[model samples]
Every structure is written in structure tokens, then in C-alpha cells.
Target: MNEMLLAAFALFVAYLYLPTAWLSGLRPAKPMTRQANHLHCPENKFYIPEDAVLRRHFVSQLRWEIEAALHPRPTDSILQRHYDALVTIKLEQRLADMGCLKPC
Candidate 1:
């Protein structure tokens, strides 16, 4: 009985280690390709005009701020105010996009 239990335990350990060893051997031997540089346009071939890019960036920033405000972990009143300000800014941008408000 003791020998049987020892054999079973050894088999279980081997079963676990065998799959891990196999998987490690099957994994890619070489490193993956490096990530693309997101900060700048690739080779400067494609570009958005400065004014439009600035407007888009502003709208994106406001959208991000609004999202962050919505998920405030501590639920602070100041965060709520920041969210409201971002929403107001987004609304103004929308109005401007529709030509209802002149850009200042």
C-alpha cells in the first residue's frame, strides 16, 4: 500500500511537470517584434493638419476626463465637478462642430 501511494504521487508530479516542460519547449525561441512607435507618425508620411489635430486632441482629452470622472473610485464632489466641466467642454465642441457656435 505504501509503495502504491508513493508511485501515484510520483506519477501526479510527473504529469504536472511534463506538460509545463512540453509547453516551454514549444514556446517561441525568438523574441517578438517590437511594438510600433505610437508617439509620432510612421516615417512622417501621414499627417493631420495642425489645427484639426489640435481640435481632435482637445476633444479626446475631454472625453477621457469625462470617463475618468464617471468611474471615480472615491466618488469625490471635486471629481463630479471635473466631469461636469468635461461634459460642458464636449458639448461646446459638438456645437462648434455643427457651426452653431463660433470657435473662440
Candidate 2:
């Protein structure tokens, strides 16, 4: 029957979309905390592409670019920049903890 088909389609759509919607807003809604400030990436005063972890050109800039893309927020540039910096810092810390980061 038409009703049965419509119900089945609705259930299929829910099954596919619900998980994505649930996971989309995983970031905290509140403003950044003091602890979060500590997690931000330090300013790069001196950078050398050859000494980078992957030896890629403009490695730090590339990282920031990727982080900015992956964790985009509907916020001002300053807040978004800070969020990306924190993401990079956390990524570096995780790599260091795992012993996967070679000294550069």
C-alpha cells in the first residue's frame, strides 16, 4: 500500500540521516574556557620546511589550513582561528604522546 511504502522510505531516510545530524554538533556550545586557551598552537616565529615532520613546504600553514577546514564554526574569524590553533596543538600533542613525532 502507499502508506506502507511511505513509512518504509521515511524509516530509511531517518536511518541514514539521524546519525549524521547527531554527530554534527559535537563541539561544545559554550565560549572557550581558560583551559582551552592553553591548548592553542603557539605562534610560529621561525619555520623551516626541511625540518618539518613531513618535510612538506609550509607545513605549519598547511596544518592550520586543514584544521580550519575540518573544524569550521559559524563564528568570527578570531574565534575560528583560535579553534583551529587548538586543534593543531592537540594533534601535535597526540602525535608526541604516541612517539610518532620526530624531533625537527
Candidate 3:
């Protein structure tokens, strides 16, 4: 049947690919490359301060937490996150002051 043939072909392909350990030993060792730890959070798109630069802020960390608690989805870019955080902080301060000021 077609199903049986397809299943057998898949198994054959998997068996051929799985034992790449033997092939690795036959090739030259890779040249030294930057270790994962040295690089900034390249893979973690959500990581704050994704790259190093002048005036780079790791503020995304705090912003993300606040956004997660207060808003959904969060901002994508560092600048957007920074702006959102600033707006949230300022609004909170204003609200706090307004609360303390008895009926105007």
C-alpha cells in the first residue's frame, strides 16, 4: 500500500540521518567561534537591550515585567518599550499625587 511504502521510506531516511556521529569524526574540527555566552541574547528576541550600543538600556527587563503585569503583548522594540515604561511611570506618579490631594 502507499501508506506502507511511505512509512518505510521515512524510516529509511531517519535511520540514514540519525547516526551523524560517524560523519562528524571524519570532518575537520570547526574553527573557534564566539561562544554562546559571549554573544548578547541573539536568539532571545524578547531579551532586553538585545545588542550593545551607546546609551543602550537594559530597561526592557523591567518594562517587560510591567507590561506583562499591566498590558498584553508588550512592545516589540527597545525604544517602544522604553517609551511605554516612561508613560506608565509618569501616569502612576500623577495618580498617586492626585489621590493624596484631598478633594480639590
Candidate 4:
């Protein structure tokens, strides 16, 4: 019975993940040009350098900021608060242009 339960749990997990993986794979990937431009936030005020290494670092930092904002936790330590603040400010300005957020 324990073995059957384990098998069922594993299958359930796989069932949940497989469609997400397949759908992601099926989605058309953004072109490289578009990706290159992604480093430029909506405001166009803050941007990662065009260099690939810098762009990767910027993306990593952005992802950390986004995750932190979405999932605030008492135990979590912010690794890049200053940089994240700057990015957040720039993003807010951009969103304000679209009337999404009040201008600062």
C-alpha cells in the first residue's frame, strides 16, 4: 500500500509538470533581438550594458528582485537591495506612463 501511494504521488507530480513543460516548449521563443532589448526596462532609463555577461548578471539580479517582491519572507535575506531599488523605481516610472501606477 505504501509503495502504491508513492507511485501515485510520483505520477501525480509528473502529470502536473509534464503539461507545463510541453506547453512551454511549444510556445514560440522570442527572437534574439527582442531578448537583447529586454534588458532595457519599460522606462528606458535603466539598462544593462549590451555585453552578454553584463546582460546575464542584470537578468539574474532582476529575477532575484521579482522573486523577492512576489514572495516576501521573514527568513529571506535580500542580496541586492540597492540595485533592486533602482530597478524598481525605473519600472514604476514606466508603469506610471501606462497609468498602471501613480507617478512618484
Which stretches of model 1 miss by more than 4 angstroms? 1-74, 100-104
Best by lDDT: 1
| Clash number by candidate, in order | 0, 0, 0, 0
RMSD, model 4, all Cα superposed? 14.5
Ranking by lDDT: 1, 2, 4, 3
TM-score of each: 0.26, 0.29, 0.24, 0.27
Structure candidate 4, residue pairs in collision? none
- Prediction 3 global C-alpha lDDT: 0.55
At residue 65, candidate 4 shows an lDDT of 62
Whole-model lDDT values for every prediction: 0.60, 0.59, 0.55, 0.59
Local error of candidate 1 at residue 61 (angstroms): 21
Distance (Å) between predicted and true CA of 103, model 2?
9.1
Query: Candidate 3 residues 27-48, lDDT tens each?
Result: 8987755444444434323322
lDDT per residue for candidate 4 within 1-104, as digits (tens), equals 99999999998998787867777887899676653455434443444456779767855775666556664533434646755566677555544444412111
Error of 4 at 43 (Å): 11
Q: Write the per-residue lDDT of candidate 2 for residues 1-104, one digit (tens) a residue.
A: 99999999998997687776675687568786653455333333222434656456545665666576675564888888787677778656544544323322
Worst 10 residues of 1 by lDDT: 95-104
TM-score of 3: 0.24
Better of 1 and 4 by TM-score: 4
RMSD of each: 13.2, 15.6, 15.5, 14.5
Model 4 TM-score is: 0.27
Q: Candidate 2: where are CA atoms >4 Å away?
A: 1-53, 57-70, 73-75
